[model samples]
Target: MGILEKISEIEKEIQRTQKNKATEYHLGLLKAKLARYRAQLLEGSKTSGPKGEGFDVMKSGDARVALVGFPSVGKSTLLSTLTSTTSECASYEFTTLTCIPGVIEHNGASIQLLDLPGIIEGAAAGKGRGRQVISVARTADIVVMMLDALKGDIQKELLTKELEAVGIRLNKKRPNIYFKEKKGGGISITATCILTKISERMINLILHEYKIFNADVVFRDDCGTEEFIDVVVGKRKYMPCLYVYNKIDQISIEEVDRIAWQPHCVVISCNMLLNLEHLKEMIWRYLHLITVYTKKPGKKPDFNDGLILRSNCTVEHACHAIHRTLVQNFKYAQVWGHSAKYNGQHVGLSHKLSHEDVLLVTKK
Candidate 1:
């Protein structure tokens, strides 16, 4: 049978199979096979052709955040409200036919926001150009899952599942698993801590399914079988996601409070313009972005134009951000901020920078 047919069959089997110690190995093998087939399917699509219109918008600004949700959930409205870009907003679903790019300027940083076409139920299965939309989302630094307040739970679950199916892990970190392939040595499994969810034998079986016989595996965390498979596939994108509940004005106060209390969630009313500023703040925090000001030898630091860099960024990152060739000079930088030991402390390229820090780089 074809890859899709095989995938469907395997999924059915996995669902029907009982989840007990007796069937653990069987389930593991099936999951590995399913992952392999899905990878093959995605690879085939890569060689298919162009990704089509509007989906290939150039990545710009300090970072990119994708606005993804069901149709008429106010993604377009959010984009328009936050940025100058005018996306076609409507009361009906599927108003956005393609990806529309906008820029949100906040805290001296420009964040590119993309209002993509609304995703349907069978998005992961390539229904309604879902694959294309998700493909663009993978390139983003963060994903903003815009959901209607009334149906926030349902939309959030469905969107999360769709994103997860395509290897987009939201609000998660990459599994702390060290995996390396070898040419001669047989499979070696080691763990820093006790592995409860997966065993060495099961690991070997999963590896053999992928035809990976000679590899070194180290488990740093007690991750599950699926996480191990993701490590093996090594094509997964683990990034932060913000669940944005829109149209909160229509919902009751109790509902809003409950949704707002959830982790990594932001409630807003694009029509009424409520809590939009908080949404911006949440986006900035989730992106882990920090601004650093540059100072001359004698002149004051230029606070008007600050360099936007990721949190825990080093002076070397600042150099690269200023200019690609700035690092070749090989010099130290003076800092005057939280990261600095003292005022105007001379720090090397490896010195981590803090938010709103002042930096003055010296040449060789």
Candidate 2:
């Protein structure tokens, strides 16, 4: 579906879900944000190309990785190589006027990549269009700092130090957050920080500088329920990014190897369009999304037509994905593959499917 449609649907669902609940200020803020997103979607559908006005917005959940660095750093050029996006690329600065999303496909699974405008030094100070791109970077799952390899190490160190000074941890653990809707009418979010390359020392430094720890404190208000605010936490427990050392053709192989020695960082020649497969493999392994097969009564098992689920996804989620009614009246499911002990075994709705599973559902 188009972004506008998705936003409209989410807006409708939010309204339906919140009908009986005492709406919070955050919920209202979410609505206003979504409305603005809907407007952007409408505008985007009616036009093409980045106009001179401001940065172009991307639909929520479209981008998994965001490319951020100084201007004329080959971000646009890399976008052209990875995805079908036709972003304007030139040697001059400010070529990318907006956040452009492109797909990077690996082993048939694709991840969305965002090519954001350059972020200069003192960007958070609101100089050099810094505020605009920083807002874009805040939403990104992975932030890639692309450097011009030919510019040498002195320039690279300067950019790295600037990001560090701004309280961005170069190495840290990144954890995933989960949001749960309670029966009582409010949403609850639970999360754990994964132990990662991002050091605790760095996280503490950023938290102190950004005042994230104070913002994250959970306390009880006059109400009976608990209240907790989200914080700008540390990186996820795991490294979810490939340090793209773009323009490898411009630098020596020894330099590339030296740069790769940086903890949790990898060197790649996006300019040479080299080692793209290796990068894709890294993503697949990181995400843990494996290929599974689905079987029809009279047909051979088809891997391409099968849905990709989490390594630990419940049968309930799969049933809902297949059809809504199946979940409401789901009785027993006959399965094959890893989830099934035997070739064809009957299991309950709570079954956790594995790779190469064939399931047949029987509803009550």
Candidate 3:
């Protein structure tokens, strides 16, 4: 049978098979087979490269975020409102046939926003532009799952499944598993923490089924068979997602209030333009961005324009961000912020920088 047909057969078998102590290993092996077949189907389809028509969307700015939802769910409207870009809005399905790029300039950080094609129920199975749309999302730092307030919240589950099928893991941290393949080691497994989710035997079975005979595996956290499978698959993208409920003007206040209580949810109306700034703030916070101001010799730090860095960025990262060669010729840096002690303390490249910190780099 073909790859898609094989994937279908494996999925059916997996569903038919019940979960129990005896079947966990079998289930894991089935999952591995399913992942490989799915990979074969989408192998060279430009999930990574988005240039030249097929999956075409050039990435830009400090970080990239994508808007994903069903057509006519106000994704285009929201994009148009948020950034200086135009996305065709219509009452019909599939108005956005390609990825539309826009820039969100917030707190001196320019974040690229992508409005991708609307996905249907069978997107993961290559229905419509689902595969192509998900490819862009895989590259995104954040995914904004836009939902229609008028439409029932079922789209939430559907969109999630579609993204997951394409190996886009939302709101999940990479497992604490460290895996390294060797030419000759014969499959060694080490767990720093006590195992609770899955046993060592199960892990061995899964790895062996995937032909991972010689490798070093370390588990730092108590994770499940699914997480271990994801690590073995090794193509999953762990990203933060914000569930944006648009067209809230059509929903009742009580309903909106209740939906807002859920985690990673924001209620807004694109036509009415409500809670846009709040949404922006939520995106910024979830993205874990830290703004660090730089000060030259005897110059005042520009607080208005901050250097946007990821949460755990270091002084070396700051130098690299300023210039590619800055890190090589760098001597030391002076910092005056929460990351340093006293005003303008001299620090090395390994020094971790905090939000709103002032950095002064001196090169050789």
Candidate 4:
């Protein structure tokens, strides 16, 4: 049997098995096996065939966000409305056949928006160029799960499952599990706090399944079995996802209000051009981007142009962003913003910068 068949069998077994304390270990083992098979299947697709056209677009801009959802859900229309790029839009599904790239300029930062082809059911299993689409999504800094307002819940669940099957954890942080492979000592498991979801025996089984005989594991937080499996596999992508419900004009006001109130969700209508600005703002906020201004000695900071950087970035990062060799001869920097201790405080390269901060770097 092939990997998919094996995955299907294990899934079936897991579904048939009873859910209780007695069968937890069995379920954990089955899930670990399923995750392994799915990882292998995705890895094998790398060399399965030639990549489709326009799928391998080069990464650009301050950050990248991918528009992923079912067909005819307004991905193309959203891209066209948000950026200069005009993606072909129609009243039918599958209008976008390739990755269409665009730029969304907001808050002194240029965000790259990719309108990927709509993914169908079983997308993670290589159905309808799903692998290619997901591969592109893996490269993005964030994913925008665009859905139709009418069938938002169903589409969101299906898309989340497909992305999860491909090892994409949307709107989640990496489990606080410190795992290191060692050569000599046997598996040593340590927990900083109580682990209610997964047991030590379950961990051992899952680790042994991956042929991890000797390793050090520490659970800094209480995580589930699947999270431990993810740490063991160590191939998952954890990124923020924005659930964008487009075509809200077709939906009722009550339904729109309900979706808008949800966390990490935005309700908009591309054809009617409603709530698009708020959608952009939510994207920026989820990306956690910041803008920093640069100043010369005895000169005012240029407010028109600012350095776009991720939150909690240090001065060294700013130096590198300015020039690759700036950090090599860097001495110290002066900051004047929220991150600074005082006005124009002298700080080292290790100093973290905040949004709208003014920076002045002095090189050796």
Candidate 5:
């Protein structure tokens, strides 16, 4: 049988098998095998994608958010409505054949939004341009999973599965596992917290299946078998996702209310421009951006256009963000804002910055 067939058989066997202490190791092994085969499939797709090596859209602005969904899901409309850039919008399917770029300027921060071609069923299996589109998603800081209000829940499930099949883990932090490969010693595993999910034996089995015989592992959090597997594979993309239900103007209030209740979801009508400001606010909130106004020596701070930084950012981060090589020069910075205890407090590169903070960097 082929690899795909073998994967199918293993999946069937796993499904038939019962879950308990007796079959846990077996299940883990099966999952490891499945992961290996999937990895192989992904490796094959690297060069075989519809757009060989996948088409590239230049990254711009402070951050990138990918709009992904089935065809005719209002992705193009949403893009044109939010930004000045216009993506070809049509009533038919597959209107967007490539990545369309737009920028959303909100609260003095510019965010790049990409409208990719619609994904169809089995898109993850190199069907259509799904894999290539997913490649863009992997690079994005956030994924806006646009959905048709008529049947969004089902679409959400399908889109989630497709993204997962290609190693995209949404709204999840990376596994708190540290690993080091040793020259000759066997695998060594340590955990800072109690591993309540799978045992160390199962971990070893999975690692061995991946041909990892000598390594050191430290789990800082309660990670599950899949997380451990991801660590072993080491290509998973963990990012935030916003489920946007569009075309709500065509749906009923009762239906709209249902989807709005879902976590990390927003209901909007791109055609009618309904709740778009709210959507923008949610996007900004999800991005967790901090505005930092710059102050040149002997000049006032520029409040109109401030530098956008991510939350928990510091003076060094601001320096690097403004200029890639600015951090190389040793320097001190002055800060005045919510982050500083007093006005014009002198702070070092390590000094953390808060929203609407004023920064004055002095170079070496």
Candidate 6:
């Protein structure tokens, strides 16, 4: 079974524990979400199944980083290079016919990296299984856009334009406003219009230009770039992504230097046996994971429920992630790192957690 299945098993075990009302409620919420996603997976409409599987599996809540790019762009090559899973890599197009998953290790933690089939031109229009690829792209927490360095800047620019032109804004906040004649009597849309602070005229002009004035939209500021457009104009999800320039060994040092200088771009060489370790490190950094450990009596230290947090996570959020009730009824936490000579330090909820910190959360 996958990580999600393992998590479900854990939750089921938690629910089976008699009289643990809180755990049961939490498990119920997780199950409801899982059921909704399973229904979506069985729907099998429009790029549904191929990419849809990722969404269904991911909604059960696992950290996912997706590999996406054009055909023959070495996405599969990179996946095999960085992880234990060996997917078929070819010299020609569409080698990855479906979503291929691999477990990659970084900082002593394993993260899920999905190698999705290539996204070609007219992907949104379902050309050459583009919709299928985009569907996988929609579900990822982080998207790694694998580019053929040999294809050069024109190809890069074209993809960037294509991603942004459809109003797939990245890292922007947009409100989810629902318009209603009565309760649940009209269409529902995710809001993609990010100019929430601007004037009504500006908003109207933007909507007219995008042709989204006729819909009820939900604003998802944290959604992916592609999903941003879908939420605003249609019901779609947006995912966050990083651009990975693959086949770096084929490019000259000077060319590599030029591409590396691109802001926030992570360039890596994937030549079957190249810097695979370094590539995995970069993936971890891109995912924003900081390793920590969970201690259990007489058992080996497990990273499971060790709080896989974003780099920006504070002690408060980490506390909540450990157990929602802890955050609600927080007292103080004792934290100790391997480097620390002290046994532990008592701190408030906002205290930022560090790598290898063993935390004991106390609640009143």
TM-scores, all models, native as reference? 0.96, 0.60, 0.90, 0.96, 0.92, 0.63
Stretches off by above 4 angstroms in model 2 are 1-56, 60-63, 150-171, 174-239, 287-292, 338-342, 355-357
Candidate 5, residues 1-364: lDDT per residue as tens digits?
Answer: 8767877788799999999989989999998898888788888878762563425988999889999999999999999999999989999999889888999999998899999899998887778987888888898889999999999999999999899878999988898899777887899999999999979999899989988899999999999898899889878999899999998998889988988998999999998899999999888888888899998998999999898999999899899878888888847888999999999998998999999999998889
lDDT of 6 by residue, 20-78 (tens): 43444444334333333333332345544343444334432236787777888888877
Question: lDDT per residue, candidate 4, 1-364, as tens digits?
Answer: 9998898899899989999999999999999999999999998999989999999999899999999999999899899899999999999989999999999999989999999999999889999989999999999999999999999999999999999999999988899999999998899999999999998999999999999999999999999999999998988999999999988888789998999999889998888899899999999999999999999999999999999999999999999899999999998899999998899899998999999999999989
* Window of ten residues with lowest summed lDDT in model 6: 223-232
Order of candidate numbers by lDDT, starting with the best? 4, 1, 5, 3, 6, 2
Best by TM-score: 4
Model 2 C-alpha lDDT per residue in residues 1-364, reported as the tens digit of each score: 7554566576566676663235543354444444345345434433653443445555443236667778887888878887888789987888887778888875555667778888776554445765556545555555666776676355466655445423344444322323222335322222254333233333334333333343232212221110111223222122244455667787788887887777545466766677666755655555566545556555666667666665688778778767788788977887888778898798888988887688777778
lDDT value for candidate 2?
A: 0.58
lDDT, model 4, position 328: 93
Instruction: Kindly report which residue stretches of model 5 are placed more than 4 angstroms away from their true locations once superposed.
Output: 49-54, 321-331
How many clashes (backbone atoms < 3 Å, residues ≥3 apart in a chain or on different chains) does model 4 have? Answer: 0
Per-residue lDDT of 33 in model 3: 83
TM-score of 3: 0.90
Model 6 C-alpha lDDT versus the unseen true structure: 0.60
Best by lDDT: 4
User: Which of the predicted structures, 1 or 2, would earn the higher lDDT when compared with the native?
Assistant: 1
Name the regions of candidate 6 deviating beyond 4 angstroms.
1-62, 161-167, 170-200, 205-239, 294-306, 314-331, 337-343, 362-364
Provide C-alpha RMSD values for all models, in order: 1.5, 13.8, 2.7, 1.4, 2.2, 15.6
TM-score order, best first, reads 4, 1, 5, 3, 6, 2
State model 5's lDDT: 0.89
